[model samples]
Target chain A: MKNNEITDITPKRRLFELNLGDVWKYRDLVMLFVKRDFKNSYKQTVLGPLWIIIKPFLSTFVFTVIFGMIANISTDGMPQFLFFMAGNILWSFFSSCLNGSSSTFIGNARLFGKVYFPRLVMPCANIIYNTIGFLINFVMFFILVLIYMFTGSNVHPNLCALLMPFILLSSALLGTGCGLIVSSVTTKYRDLGVLVSFGVTLWMYITPVVYPVSQVAEPFRPLALLNPVAPLIETFRYGFLGSGTFPWQYLILSFVVTAVVLVFGIIVFNKVEKNFIDTV
Target chain B: MREMNENCVIKIENLSKEYRLGAIGSGTLRHDLQSWYAKKRGKEDPNQRIGAKQYTKGDTFLALDGVNLEVNRGERIGIIGTNGAGKSTLLKVLCRITAPTDGRVRFRGRIASMLEVGTGFHAELTGRENIYLNGAILGMTKEEVTSKIDSIIEFSECEKFIDTPVKRYSSGMFVKLAFAVAAHLDAEIMIMDEVLAVGDMRFQKKCIKKMRDLATEEDRTILYVSHNMNTIRDLCDRCIVLDHGKIVFDGDVEDAIKIYLGSANENFRALEYVGNEHKHHADRNDLCLQFVRYNGKEDSNLSKKSYHCG
Candidate 1:
């Protein structure tokens, strides 16, 4: 019963008070949420977690046939199969992170309404869970690249390949940021929730996931790179397949945009979380 | 700012909450656009319900208005109120589930709330796993829950189904397990919202006994909200009655219940009594006397007889 343990409940805190220490105190809860996500997503399924790899495998096959074979899109002279696989793995991670985190307020409205916890735990769990899936896909992609290399294919991973973790994290941060922003808005207006999945689909096409960024018209290349995800995907392909462009300046620009979005998203999320239950 | 007393465990000043009327987003883009257009013309919000009384601010009304109170340590308080009495809203604000529109509450020590039992239970998770999950959600560390895990399971009386998914458990069993977890929470202040409305009679009695022990033995402060005045009288030494976001009575338990039942008001009349006529209802379980009306006549069994009126 120490008097110094007093906690004040007020209507407004500072706008940028992200309450990171509160989140840190609840780290165990975050891990539990991640564990729950992992368990629930695969439970009772025939393939269980194998679906994570199977998903990318099927999507890569479709993109190779549709974009590489039929549309005859160039892969910057890299093998079309591996090229598509690289983009698919990275893009799926980013998109899933975005879509999953975007529904934080809406999906857990019942849970959020009943109890009090740092609201960021939901999206943090989502990103970590999605990151686990991305790691599995990355392993599968790496094995494929190794097999292709032994067979004397020109595709070889370079020193740039070591930047994969950074690329993955940036994509995760960007997606979670955008998702938090959308979730905050969707608490008041559910139309945004309905629009998120479709919007992510459209976002992928512009992100050079199926085609090389080089194929975009020269004048529009800079515009496409401004997408933040565009350069990250290019860097991923550059690292793994060793054929895509790696514009250092654009990469820096992508990181800057990600930082801005993540910071802004957190601020908006903090503001809404105080009383989002009333509206949500 | 007011000076806080050393013994005061909770202090509130001018607490108020305002909730928007009608729809938060009007449920559709067209309606939102219409509201926006109407606002631009300095007209009433198109989304506002027709003939709804507008408060001082448009389409918003206070749930808790200028409530101020302070509680000393180790006080077992019962909060009684009718529907829409802001009892739940005040608990929500204290638990930090939702922020107040204005004012603040300062409290010492951690607050564990049972606003609703099983707040984060997953259907796919086993009963044992959910105990851990729910414990964590209520701010208990893993080791803390681990140490109390055996007692929690034992208290729940669901030992056989501990490893089974909660979805497979009966509704009664679900509530039993949920209450067990909440009962084990080690916090200085416990805020509960009518959690005993479910479960069997034996279990309800067990819960009441356990809570009484916690308040007396552990010296923890307890604030219970309930419509069951019998339990209130049994557990709380002090009581507060709320109506329309204001405290109507705050004193002895018997007096508070009298005020809540309208027996203390001369103009109020009791239309119905809890006679054996309502005994045939299948849901009737606790038939203890709750309220009585004198009607200017002496009845020795009046306290024993319960009356019902609104």
Candidate 2:
């Protein structure tokens, strides 16, 4: 018998009580939530997962024509299609994760109100689900790269290509961290909910998703790297398409900033989870 | 550690939950900011009473007030109360679905709550998938649900449709499947809130029997909230009656029900006293509603306007 098991409920929980152990114990529930997301997201739809592929494909083509041709944005001397696809893959991954986690509380209020599992499970499940979506997008990008390579393109994926996993982890963390903070605040002041999607759209313009960081004026280049996601996308292009600079200091700063944002997000999220049922 | 009884499986002390009477945070950030600015300038909140402080009596609704309780192992406790009298709030706080505004609750073992059946079930998921999802939400691991899947399917008696989506199932079938999953929960403490209100009469009896066996054989502690006096009498060894966010009675089942109905009759009498001309009309209407709500079997007499029974 598990005599040592016990649980206490109180009006207030400590600020740092993240309950990571409970999240681990409820790992099955997290997986089930992820599976539910997968099943329900595409259910009864004819196109289904094809939408995942078509979305980025269409966006890539649009960016290639609009920015690459009309605006004459420098892709740092890379093919317009590949340049847009690489940036599209990383940006979409981070933004989707951010948008999804941003609505975690409001989206699952019914489930959270009736059950007692760790509240972190919802955000964690979303991060995993969005990661799966991100991976699919990445694979499509990779296949496009291979087709470009076979057709006599000058693209060369370097040793930096191995950093794909690390880049992905940091980006996911950053996105969910910011999303969690927004989710927590929206519990009380829902005005933020209306602004989240719009803010993410505006945020993309400043992060060099369509245009390379190299195109930024020299004076403002450093300022651009200060945005944590800037160096992530830059490094992603640097590795995969071999077109962008490898600023190691900016990448390190990006990771440190990601770690801090993620920690702060989780703390705020934990604080709100205790009583969010009232406000949400 | 606080002093706890060795046999007590659940303990709640000075528990209270207060909710703002109106929209949360005064409805908008603009109003919240206005209130904050007013407070900073040494003025009363513009959104609140002219001279009243925050959380004043009129500003908040006390859902549960200073409730203290303890339950030993293998006890089935029935909680009865009028709507908004805090029965559901008590179960919610105990389940940790919502935080209490004051005090604390401690439990000695694993607690599984069915605040509502099919709590996390997705409409698109099949009955089998929903069983797994619902079980996981109730704190069961994948292996635990896997082991009990067959028994759950058999208990629901919808084996043929187990693979079909729950959205396609009749409401009765859905409740049966959901209850079957909740019935198979492996926990030392179970908190249920009127989960058997749906489904056929035979199924409700079967569920009550299942809960009884769980309490007797497995020594699980159960805290059940229901308005049905018969079920309370049939299933509970102990009973609690709440009135206006306070525990008016807690004792043997028969005595608790007596106190509950006694007070209910008094409330009706008070209502009748407030209006003399419509006394007879109001009395019959209230009784008919109460009969239909609290006692389904007496619904046959709902048509009788002169029906008067205490």
Candidate 3:
């Protein structure tokens, strides 16, 4: 599809057209919502923005102690703390976007009912805020790596690290696509909310966050790779830790799935946004 | 009709919105299951069987029914009605926030509606951020909002708190900023619903002035819904009176107010007040109308008799 021709004309198309130009026109509103989410997420807290660092900091510490120390998990030549932190930060961003976008309609029903802005702006804002949080956490992870290097622990920094932002974007796009689909469905069927909360948690295990993809058994490895997030996370870890197996085929598959899901998400989101206030 | 078309920017015809208020739990599940079952059976809905009581009395209500009206460009129209008279619902339909169930509304230009102050505001956002946000939500482009940002903040009188999170703002300041963004929105048609009631009297005066200026100077169509009859009279060139989801009167401001006030007077008379029964009657007819009080000594004449109408 061309850039300008974003609309799909189906026979089942409802009353109104979904105008992407309107969404583009309302980009400032999207930014404001992003700012609101960023500030309100940590406002009134004693730690303030430090909570962004502290959350993944503590989670990485726990994972390093339990999975790296106690279970003696292999870090594939990279420092255990750095290895797990990278995975945690990446997964945290994706999960946060998913959880936030999934609740978009239900969370803002009052505002949605009173206003007529493109509802896509809410989820788009969520993706932007989560990306910022991920960037902050990523910076902290890098600082921790430098600390480990100063302490004489072996750490290899590779050129692939430059690809971190692209990986983050891919994950965000995937998360946003899935999140919008869930949010749109949840507006009509409230059960989708309950199901998604549990689904995301289970999905994290299937993605290779706790363990390296190399550890998965033979037959199940292909099935695990089939999980769209699995390849994205694997690629992110490979870019950072320089350890995980990066299959180009699975990467292509993940990109295809992300695009398809995103298109479906936008379609469903646009459809629901028009009249979801009534249904909600 | 041709002459009316020249001035009119909005024409709503046969507009009706229906809402189905299903019974509590079992009814929803029953309807869902029955619909699914009927779909599988490849037949018409069994629930639509003859005399099935498709809707119970308490379960259904029509918010609007066959409402038709025309609003002209550059005309300041005030929609006045009592609560639940579907004033807000009509605006919602026109704004396309909610679709009409059975009719169409044809609008000639972009519509910006302030159904309530701060409709999509996030308390955590700063006033400056929210100005752009609110403007964009009202359908302005970022560039348009950026150009109008200074004027919006100036008009709102919220310069000191421009960078502060709106959560810290007092309710009055929040409303002021919200209304400012709305007022500055560059839309052809502006629909305001009691938003001027939020701020202080001075701010209300400023808002009314701005709305008046928009209608006159900018030649924008304005549709205002407010309970403030005096403000309506002062600000609007034309007015519409709605009663029971229908337009009872639509014309020049004076005629509309007269119809509205006349009906209100009748309603007030029908409502019995102790020791004030004869207050509302016109003193024209002696036999048909009765007065219960007289300031002077009573005479034997029927015109001088102080009698209450029975």
Candidate 4:
């Protein structure tokens, strides 16, 4: 009902008035952003959205060769191609969220300086756009899953597979939450920008992407498990490949960490949004 | 209280915005921490943050200070100021793009602004797509934009290139589309800032006429900022002249313009006098140098004289 009663804007607003309700009113803007992101990212490229699948496939090929053949990384008895494909696809989804949203403020300084809307929409749209790429890349994933099944391999996608979307959502939320914090920080200290992109690469190494949790020894093993993304990726592998551990406790832990991180990101982001135009 | 009549759509009271000049913040984390520590210790902020200092020297400034204004529905108010007079800053605060450092801005109805042309326009998106995107950014729903799509294209005069990516369009074509989209926003209050400077004279006239219609027929409130006095005088019924972020004059368009134009000539005269500033106290050699060997005159005929102008 307050929608129609004049907006009173003051210098000192409540720090935590997330105003998600206002975001829903601008749903059309978010859709346009999704559309714009797709158009801009895919446009002019010769292959268009085909680049979505091609990118993951090429990376998977490289990852499988280097980690599986050269270094002989473990895939938990699953085919190297299928395992790397899943890992690359899922890891990309999470990293893209981080990489994309982390620069949301710096990348959008011009647009943000001119207009007003829920600042969250920019990062939210990033996740959605990346999801589009992930889904297209999902086709490559599905085909690989089918290929292993037809060959009578040990790729048994189980009922746990139903949880894949939810797990991916959690990873996206976790990445976006962390990305929001980084985005706000980078606006002040640009050094973080360089650190984050580099950190993400190091992050993928520790998340058991190229190897399985079972292959890591005890001390390093627990460290990998402590990575918030580790359990989600493990759950994803368990769901889609039926070979990884699935402790509900870890999943619950991942969910809680994601919830906390997202709330913190929003709080920091909300504070940054008010005066960022000055410092940014 | 009278300004709060149902007819009034906007009220800005005791509005002030302070900005630290040289480099925003303390330029480094140590200084930022020092500023925080200053606040904690109940000491004067070493950062000298907030509060507008006179422009005579240093970086701190007030973009707006204790400014108060009210506009009734259907009023077209022109805001004119020299660069950095806070015209754009006030509009930015009005649009909620940036929060004011102090005071409040009250808006009775939805407001859409053209802070700049092609604000969110991406080069890769087609002109048609940008129309929807821009409209949505202005807070229009899909159904509303779809309904106006045809008219928008016609108004922009980019019918043939509607499907083509905007990157290929000339700057003029882009502004036309952007202005057309802004024109279609049905909000009760509209704010514009120097965006009309784009495009040709004929299109500018068209836009002025449309703005007239919007104010008169549509019963909308308009706040416009422009350096073009002709557009301001021709379109706005009232004017506010801003000098160093404060409204020096707020009244009838012609009178406010007279004050604005008067100050401008004063500034020009002041600048003209600035050329003589160094001469008033020039070093002896800089005072007057008469070139030698001109017209076969010998070097011995050269003259160097010093005379203080003041």
- Candidate 2 residues A154-264, lDDT tens each? 787888888889899999999999999999999888889888979999999999999999889999999999999999999988888888898789999999999999999
Lowest summed lDDT across 10 adjacent residues in model 3 chain A is found at: A1-10
User: Cα deviation in Å at residue B134, candidate 1?
Assistant: 0.5
Q: What shift in Å separates residue A85 of candidate 3 from its native position after superposition?
A: 1.7
True contacts kept of 1: 0.69
Candidate 2 on B166-228: residue-level lDDT in tens? 999998999999999999998999999988666888999999999999999989999999877
i-RMSD of model 2 (Å, 1 decimal): 1.5
Model 3 sits at an interface RMSD, in angstroms, of: 7.0
| Best-performing candidate as measured by DockQ | 2
Best by lDDT: 2
Off by over 4 Å in 4: A1-4, B1-3, B26-59, B267-310
Minimum summed lDDT over a 10-residue window in model 1 chain A is located at A1-10
Question: What TM-scores does chain A show, candidate by candidate in order?
Answer: 0.97, 0.96, 0.89, 0.96
Q: Write the per-residue lDDT of candidate 1 for residues B1-310, one digit (tens) a residue.
A: 2477777888988999988775466666678889889989999897778897644457677789888888878888999865566999999999998999899899988898898978899988999999999999998888889999999999999999999989999999999999999999888898999886558999998998899999899888899998777788778989887766767677888867665654322222343343332324312312222332223334323422332321
How does residue B59 of candidate 4 score in lDDT? 57
Pairs of residues at least 3 apart in sequence or in different chains that clash in candidate 4 = none
List ranges where model 3 is wrong by over 4 Å.
A1-16, A45-47, A139-166, B1-7, B23-60, B125-129, B141-154, B157-169, B261-269, B272-310
Residue-wise lDDT of candidate 4 within B45-162, one digit each (tens)? 7877478452333556798878889888899999986566789999999998889989998988798878988789889989989999999888888998999999999999999999
Judging by DockQ, tell me the better candidate of 1 and 3.
1
- What clash count goes with each model? 0, 0, 0, 0
